[model samples]
Target chain A: MSGPDLLVLATVATLAGSGIYLLLERSLTRIVLGVVLIGNGANLFILLSGGVTGRPPIRGLFGSEGISDPLPQVMILTAIVITLALTAFLLSLSHRAMRLTGDDEVRDDEEDRRVIARVERELARHRVREEVERMRRIHAEEGFRAGLRARLGLRGTVRRERRELRRRMREEWERQMAADDPEGGMDTTMGEDSP
Target chain B: MNNVLVPLPVVLPLLAAGLRLALAQRLVRVQRGISVAVLAAVVVIAAVLVYQTDHYGPQTMHPGGWPAPIAVMLVVDRLAALILLISGVITLCVLIYAIGQGASDNDESTPLTIFHPSFLVLLAGVADAFMAGDLFNLYVAFEMLLTASYVLITLGGTPARVRAGMTYVVVGILSSVILLIGVALCYAATGTLTLAQLAVRLADLPPDVRLVLQLTLLVAFGIKAAVFPLSAWLPDSYPTTPAPITAVFAGLLTKVGVYAIIRVQTLLFPGEALTELLLVAAACTMLVGILGAVSQTDIKRTLSFTLVSHIGYMMFGIALASRAGIAGAIFYVAHHITVQTTLFLVAGLVERRGGSTSMDRLGGLARVSPLVAVLFFIPAMNLSGIPPLSGFLGKLWLLRAGVQEGTWPAYALVGVALLTSLLTLYTMCHLWNRAFWGDRGKLPERGQIIEGRRGLSGTGIVATAAPGTMVGTAAALIVFATAFTVAAGPMAGYIDRAATELLDRRAYLTAVLP
Candidate 1:
């Protein structure tokens, strides 16, 4: 709206814009710089929002219009302290990162990528296992039906084939029961029932 | 009203933290005793505040006896009191867990000794955030907690912890800056910082300016709450911390952000201007967050993703903007704080017992320690929204609210919420299967080799017997979560009244500004 206001706005915009730009960089130092710039920009914005520059608000201020709002300055002071602490923290982090990885640049999170890949592989393995189990069941059912048809057509092997089929069915039942059991115990009833 | 008790929850913890710091070089046991006593006192104070507020309306205290508009004020209504009580209880449990952990370690006095003071400071920050009656005060409160978190997160200064802490610190500072900008904008528009006064002044601002101010605040708070697109830093950073620190952070920090959001939305900007936007964010946060959870391999990482996902349910309640919805959100917040912290604490135990948090290297926990298994199972099931648990009750309440709202988006969110709950169950079961039920022999040996190779030997999971106090603290959290279910009827009634008072701002304004 006025010259001082426009200058403050431009400065805030430039600082915030550059801050965001640096934030997108890969190095930890650049990121810290970004935070510093953005914090300064915010403080400036708060100061600007207090109104055009005026005398510091003190006990002897002429009037409200003649005195600058002390609240924003107080807020800016707090923000500055917070930013300084954060900057110091970030600098230490950068130093630590350099010591740990021998570099100050942020590396891609290989663990997360590996985890996603592992999860996908696990899901694929699970799907394959389910499909194999399904196919095996279908094949068993078909084989049983075929064996029954062959036994009825040829009575000579009927008795032997029926015995074999009964044994296979008992095994299948035991397997199913074992899969369903929470305790993973063998079902003793299968042997008794089979006899 | 006993206004004297209003600031005690915050002040007591601050005093204890200072005392702990002064005695930092002394015996650790003395520090632990003082920290625990102060937090216990805060819990009693919180409980008293809850009783007084519920029976006699909100209580307010202005520091230095200054009037509300000009000086810092602390207000303890039912919502704040409930949050304070739960945070105090959880912090106490986690403090015990930390002490137990430190006692078992070789370096009992040096590096780990700072935990007591830092944790007490964190509790003070939480209490202050919950009771803060002004927006700027809330910002300061956030910084206080976050500063302590930065220290806690990188406790050992390991490579991984440092890396994660860098990201955490950067994101936190960025969000704080955005929050400051929002506060400045709001002050510029409304000429007041006190929430009650802002409530009166904000309604008179131009609609466009109000919307801008509201969206700015929401964006900042959303990042802190780990709402969608803003939540990527959480899973990366949270899994690197020690058990007790991670448990407290996961339990209370983001919820503080959510508390601030609730305060502003209900008090300063009570309208449906951003409801649609929030609904979309809630739905996205739910689906995306859980999907991420389903994809994680480590127990802590999975729980972190689930934490992000569950924030959606609270947002769903907030977006609904109905009394039932808000009440459900409040209850869900309480239930989630307990259950989530319990699960993390148990995960810590699991790591201690199994030698690795990665599921590929963990197994036979059920056989190894039945108590740990049972502790993990209860909270895991509760968090998954199992019937008859507090999680189920909270989700049911939210769904009922959604159905009552009956908009197409709301219905869609109802469906998403249900799906998210089931998916949560699936993820928990996935963790349970690999970490608890399987044979120890079935675990891959390569995963153990990788853990050793990562140079994470100091913080890497180890097969140590969990201390009795650590397990006891986790068990206590589970008991609290169960108590939530047992006392659901009365708790829901209290939360409903809190929500009602929240929606009707005159009570809050009169209490603060009078």
Candidate 2:
């Protein structure tokens, strides 16, 4: 109830580290035990997070001076129960795995592993090929556009032609409006200048 | 009605199993009938609960009329209802299949007799798990199911089954012990056992404390869900079981863990860090799972691996913590539960026909058993995310949600998802190629048709009895899976609503604690 949060956290972390170390050991029994220890460390971390307030959260009747948060306690209860059931099931699995194959360490079935590895290699190759194809298409498009531009003088000619065409169209439109309305005879001077 | 019904899910199978084991030794028919009838009644009750839950909010009934957080309560929410519906339909089909298959070649074996009772107990455990409102109750439910599963997996005690069962039991025991430690720690931290209460209480805890608790809970559930790194036990253990048992376990067990993860992530710890961690775990799960699945030649093993891989998709949705993601995840759960089980059942049928689950031993099944081929084909395609199927729709929603989130990781995960889908297709194709498409390879030798000598004719007739039970089960599931597909708009909407309900947490938290 009065331990430093850092110390509590450190203890759990150490336990977890040990659990992982055990897990790394090949035997199924050690691996399961490692898992169990790791889980304990995790639970301890959760407990430490609630803070070591004055007292455990069991406030009964009337005024409460200071009580620990009740939420984490309840959550841990649920979590503990679940892990217990899970651990049991997993332990059963580990024991059976050991018996089925005379080895304690999990050895991948050779055939299964080979097939899996081959499929992965193929997928990786396919992805690389796709990337190459994408780059090639991008390169080809750039070359084609550049070649077409040179042969046609398309950029400058298109720009100049569009400008000239716009000027002519505007002048034509103005003359047509003036002719139809006959309201402004000054359009005659403009036509003469244009000719 | 409320009182009895509230506890029936846990009590019925347990009581029936106890009685059958003790006094009903002579009357096998009576034992089987009672077990089946009780399960049927559980299904009916669960259906009614589903209807009621949809109309009203979640249905919570406390035994002895005690207030929640003090007395144990059974709450059936939309998610719970969905699982119940699936469990019901699957249990019915499996029970029928078992009945049709005639227990075993040896009727006198105690294992054969216990099948009915054990199967019922498993269902009861599942029901209790779904309905439990308190964390401690969930543990009890888990134990109930595990105890039953232990019996079912090792029922015949054949060398292989026992071997597999031993692994299952040991792993299970280890998880239980860890769970207990975690629970004890939680109690020391928060001092309560109710879920809703803990949700509020947990938020108030210091950040570090909360994070630690959250991670511990996730790890426990992760193992159950078979998330990538923790999933080594699944492929070996699942494929070796009898079809019906495998089917149920495939469909419901892992999903239950996922359901728990969803509940914990959204309801208990809505922190951003947890979501981020979940997203990463999900990505690893999907990529790693499918990769493992692709290399397998045995149909059952392949599907089992895929099952682990596909769990990532569900986790992806849940990890996003957005309404769309959670909804998509929920829909994915429903879809995967049906599709996955159907695939396993199909594998079972193929084994019956071809005398082996290995691709080498099986070929040309499509020629001999068109019905089996079709059954296998539909679910296979559906699982691979083909259009107009629930699998495709579920993935689509999840990917869209991921993209919409626009986080770099989420976007990258969407890409991972696309790749996984393709790989799923490839492995499924492999199963199709070797199991259904060839000549004599597709047919089981007459000896393989029936395993042993006791009334081989009767059993063989049942085994080859058109594989109707298998087909029928697949067909019914496909219909539901398709319903999720065609009605995805409405179903997704329901999921969205449920997601909102989960995220808001007002109803759940207030109902229990206030």
Query: Using Cα atoms with residue i matched to residue i, what is each candidate's TM-score against the true structure?
Result: 0.87, 0.75
Instruction: Judging by TM-score against the true structure, name the best candidate.
Output: 1
Clashes of each: 0, 58
lDDT of 2 by residue, B292-365 (tens): 88878778889889999999999999888888899989889888988988888777677666656778667777
Worst 10 residues of 2 chain A by lDDT: A179-188
Residues B1-514 of candidate 1: C-alpha lDDT, one tens digit per residue: 2388988888888898888778777866677788889989999999999999999888998877776688888888899999989999999899888777766653454446666777888888899999998889999999999999998888767655776788888889889988999999988887788889988998888899988999999999999999997988998899877788899999999899888888888888887437788899999999998999998878998999999999999999999989988998999999999998999999888877775587877888888778999999999999999999999999999999999999999999999999999999999999899889879734333224222311111433334568799999999999899999899889999999999999997788888876
State each model's TM-score restricted to chain B. Answer: 0.96, 0.93
| Candidate 1: regions farther than 4 A off | A61-65, A110-112, A115-195, B442-462
- DockQ, per-model, please? 0.20, 0.05
Residue B513 of model 1: what lDDT? 77
- For residue A158, model 2's alpha carbon misses the true position, in angstroms, by 73
Off-target runs (Cα >4 Å) in candidate 2 are A1-195, B1-4, B103-108, B445-467, B486-490
